[model samples]
Target: MPKLRKAQVMILDGILSILMAMTISYVLFAAWPQHRETTGQLALERAGYDIVNAFYEDKEIYQTIRKGFEAKGYLSASEVEYLRTRLYNYGRMLGVSRIDVDIEGSEQFSVEVTHSTPARREQFTLIMPLRGGADDRIIRVSLWE
Candidate 1:
């Protein structure tokens, strides 16, 4: 085979470099959105856990829940409403998009509170048991965008 001319070799090298750059760009563009989505989902999960911990840790919130549990074996409508408001406010302060709370024991109650328009499809749930209860009452906190 004849040796390649310098000009032809340089042209081939330029084309190869261009193709490599395009391939790299395409891979980065394809993977970036997925990485961002995974990060968002992780943040939501952490927010859900924090919300549950906040409820259990705060004296006022803990007392409110305990009062409801002791009084009627379930949360009263007003108590539930208060909790919805309080939780929604707290979640908003933390930049959470939407929150749904579910309490289940002998009865099941649920509340959905939205701080803003729901945009994301991913959801994170935190399940926690109420303390000092003879019944197995579980509180489920769900956070989503």
Candidate 2:
């Protein structure tokens, strides 16, 4: 084996000293507990996205939206009620205090279903097209605790 130069030896010693110091400090102080707030926010956002996708994919919801678009300018009372019920049920299933669904379509037609006033903190909003193809209708789902 080639003999290490003095400079190489000094560098290796410095690296080893740093490693030892780090190990000792870790052993004495222990590992810090990671904060989960960011993780929770990501999960909340994911749930909101899933809810919006469900709304986009559901056949009944699609039919209602399509009919409303084809018919008189906006959704009927029954259709609005159906959407509200669905959003409320989803909120309950997710164990969130409130969930809001806002539907906006072309021609300035909009419908909103809000169960309760949200705290505004720890909320996630997801927006997606109402139908699969190029559709004027878009849905926004907000989930908050």
- Predicted candidate 1 versus true structure: per-residue lDDT over 19-122, tens digit per residue: 88878987877533243335776776677667877877877777777788777777777887777778767777666776766666523333445545776644
TM-scores for all predictions: 0.63, 0.57
The sequence of per-residue lDDT tens digits that candidate 2 reaches over residues 32-72 is 45575546566666667666766667777667767776666
Q: Output the lDDT of residue 85, model 2.
A: 72
Give residue 138's lDDT in candidate 2 (0 to 100).
55
Q: Which ten residues in a row have the lowest lDDT in candidate 1?
A: 30-39
Per-model CA lDDT versus the true structure: 0.66, 0.62
Query: What does candidate 2 score on TM?
Result: 0.57
Evaluated at residue 61, the lDDT of candidate 2 is 67
Q: Candidate 1: which stretches are off by over 4 Å?
A: 1-38, 105-116, 120-131
